[model samples]
Target: MTEPNLPSGNDTDTNSSAIPGTAAAWERATLERLAMATLIEQRQARRWRNGIRIAWLVFVAAVAWFGWERGAAPADVSKPHTAVIEIKGEIAAGGDASAEQVVSSMRSAFEDSGTQAVVLLINSPGGSPVQAGIINDEIHRLKAKYHKPVYAVVEEMCASAAYYIASGADKIFVDKASIVGSIGVLMDGFGFTGLMDKLGVERRLMTAGENKGFLDPFSPQTEKQRAYAQTMLDQIHQQFIGVVKAGRGNRLKETPETFSGLFWTGQQAVEMGLVDQLGNLDYVAREVVKAEELVDYTRRDNVAERLVKRFGASIGEGSVHALKLAPSLR
Candidate 1:
């Protein structure tokens, strides 16, 4: 009687319930995975759409800027006018008033048949002497070849390297109150040896040549190195003096303070023979050149160059930071 007994109803019901629960769990998990995959795909699609829109906007902006720059070329040069070239801001190798820009503009002005004369509109606190020297030499050469009188019209301030280039002009005109002159050469730097000593820091610099690290700020500068630097500066000063003397000739009223690296008012400069007269661009064009119309021929950085420079500024900044560890000229 005991062997013939079957399974209980409760056991059968529990087994059947367990099988449906497991299957339901598996189906729910699969549905969840499918929903998550759809969400991920939607997010990726949205990102791609945003990226494309941004790229299209940038492309359109670049094209429009380029077109505007190209269409902004100067008008015809074959018209009677006074050719004006601006020498404004710092005179450096890659600046707006650099030797290359100024020289190129001068050539264009001088070659034009209708150009009555070339005028330099200078406004600067001065910069690199090497750049100034190149421009000064080019001025003399162009004048000799073209036989066109080149005049310098000063506004606001013109000192140091700016005056260096102006010296080559046939005549320099300045406003009565304009600042002028700074006839000298300089090599400025700083020393941190005492500070480093106080901080208990050591500079372990290695060089093949004995004087290779002479200009290093953290290291102590020897008397011999100082003398060598002074000699170099003196030679450059003499060269600058010679250029001014040759340019001004008998007109310059030489005095002890003339080449002492001092600046003066435009009125005082006129009295000292450093400037010709009190005038302006309009006055020079109308009275001197007898050409009323002024035509500008200044070369400037184009739209594309400016954009490239702006984007590459971070790279340039990193290079400058590295260069700061080494000695350099101003």
Candidate 2:
């Protein structure tokens, strides 16, 4: 007997394809998924691009703002005012109290027709003597040229090189408790020879000249080198003494301890004729300058200056340290 006629493979396929809507629905779902995935990836990429663009714009705006602020003068000089310049921090070569910044501020103040006098608002422990010397010389020159009195107003502590600059002022005003002097120069460094011995490390230093590595802390200092250093310090000390004498004139009460690199209270400074008076900035502006209006002409580092300095420091980090022969007043 013949078995009942079952559906052939071709007949089954035809039956499945007869449902056209089911096949079309499956294809539509796959296409929709692919489209959604593509849209998501595009959105993420766009967000990243926008974020970078916004960051770039912000950076450019900040740079421009800093540039404008640094280049712009303090204020308009249409009326009489007291021009104030601040000397606050270590007086180093590229510091806030650098000679370049101080001199530029002084020039601006002296050149202004509406400025009655220039005031140096000082709050520092002091730094490089060379920087201080430049500022001191410029102060004298500006005073001579403009015939305007320059006063020094000490805030907290004005010692060493700070005092050196203050001495150039026509009058020095200080608070009663202010630290006022440290009239000396010194070169300080750490001797790592003992540490190196303990660590069993040898220093490999090569120099063309015999004295090139004279003050290297890793090496033993010779007697001749010590004497040479002392001689140099003595010369600088004599130069410092001369400048103090010239600046203070008869106002200074000459004594052995005056230039002994000792700091004193403001009251003692006044008694020793180191400080002219016990007063503040307001007192000087209102009473001394006779113009209550105050204008700050201090040259300070703006954003651009700070960025440049940081960049330079980063680039020079791998360089060898130079021997500092110039005396520091810290």
Candidate 3:
């Protein structure tokens, strides 16, 4: 076998050389497949990123549109129109019916040359005497400066500070069945001291000033503090009474029960001289203002404003909680 080179042996060598070529080809194919897979994954990731970007743009555009729509004036400013300012819901500092919003709206309405009159559409259970006072003061000032009549049209209800605000108007219009009047001031809270005593829990309150924790619900309130609080409430109530008297003038029918925190129907309010006449917003716009085209100049919170306010309130509340302070009054 050694003497002559066998063809069969040569064939075995050839087969051995072909084996490496076949393995190299297989490796190249595998590498190509891996590269293709990587390319597909990259394309998919890019598509996802593009989609996310597009979605974010759409969201931003929608928000911008919504904000514009919410804040834009509905009617043309060139024609004579009844400028309507809404005072709805709780009239708190950060609310839609806040003093800042109402006052600003009134100022704009009064400043407009095309405005015939300003109308306050009031529908609230009332809140914050301070807010109401600011609005009332602005109404009087604007009325004096602009020489334009300001009328209040009561909807379902107008009580407490709501009535305080309404009284500033030149005249108050109301529906016969609408609820009105709650001319009073009060500071309301609950005593948790008794509950804590029953539960065997002691209150740990620390204050820099002697009367700093005067109204703390967890602590026991002394008779002196109670009397002081009552005196303060009485003073505020007197101030409220003065405003109502001044606003209504001799038109108001003085009665002992009138300022007793009692609410009455609009018909009863008219009888008591708390309201001028039974009428609605449309009636006031058409008959009183002589302008059927109503334009709203009410200052309202847009999406961004509302978000900022909510965020600020949350931060303030958190800080107050961390300081272990009771909720503050307006």
Candidate 4:
């Protein structure tokens, strides 16, 4: 019959090739779609990351602005009030109770006509003598300039440098149980030479001057160095004694153990003239100052400043201060 209309070999081969070609084209299209999807997802993720970063920056900026405005707001000076300046914690440079902060607050209080009197709200274990001296000097200067009396209201403990600052006040009020008076200078450190010898650990320290490394804790301390340090302590102690004597005048009851780095309870302090009386902030403001309304003028670190210090701005400086084996008023 004409072998019928049987398919030729060429037709069969063409049809099979067409089927394979179609599969290959399908795979390419599928791969292209997958790639496009991946690109879109990556783009979305990048946008989200950017958005989060921006939000964080905005939040930080808002906090900074609010802190600034709060600090910059002017104090209400319409009525008579007792202007209070806080001296809490360690008194050191770049600290909350630093000379800069205390002095600035003092100046503000003294300059304000509405301020009936200035009160130093002190509660510290003491710190740098230099900072304390600055605040003390400013207390005298501000009192002389404005003819305003400055009183000290002690809470908890006020010793060493805190006592030094309080010495400049007209009167010091304290709680009956408050610990007061460690009126001395000390340079405390541990000599690791013996420990290192036991452990066979050698310390290699380089310095340009012999005295530069004298305070090095890992090295040995010589007799001469010890004497030198003691002499320094004596000199600083004399200065502290002089300040206390001048400030306390006839009010202070002199005793052998008064400046011997000894501490006493607030009751004992009052008996010894180290404290004026047993009282509190409210008592001082109402009775002593004759102004019941109290106004705080303490200059503390704002949020932006604290953030800067918290980040990395003053971290190295703080570490250096911590690592120092130098003299202190405590």
Count of backbone clashes, every candidate in sequence? 0, 0, 0, 0
Per-residue alpha-carbon lDDT of candidate 4 for residues 1-330, written as tens digits (9 for 90 to 100): 566888999999998899899999999999999999999999999999999899769758966675654252156776899999899999999888999989988988888889999999999999999999999999999899999999999999999999999999999999999999999999998888999999999999767668788888999989999999999999999999999999999999999999999999999999999989999999999998899988888887776766656655555878778867654422
| Alpha-carbon local distance difference test for all models | 0.90, 0.89, 0.90, 0.90
lDDT of 1: 0.90
Cα displacement (Å) at residue 62, model 1: 1.3
Cα-based RMSD of the predictions, in order? Answer: 5.5, 8.5, 8.7, 7.3
Each model's TM-score, in the order given? 0.80, 0.77, 0.77, 0.79
Q: Mind giving the per-residue lDDT tens digits that candidate 2 earns over 1-330? A: 999999999999998887797889989999999999999999999999999899768767777767736543555796999999999999999788999999999998899999999999999999998999999999999999999999999999999999889989999999999998899989888789989999999999777778888788999898999999999998988888888888888999988999899999999999999989899999999999999889989987888768667756866865524424433322
Give the per-residue lDDT of model 1 (tens digit) for 22-73: 9999999999999999999999999999998997688568856675342222
Maximum-TM-score candidate: 1
Higher-lDDT candidate of 2 and 3? 3
**TM-score-sorted candidate list, best first:** 1, 4, 2, 3
Work out candidate 1's RMSD over C-alphas.
5.5
Q: Which candidate, 2 or 3, would have the higher TM-score against the true structure?
A: 2
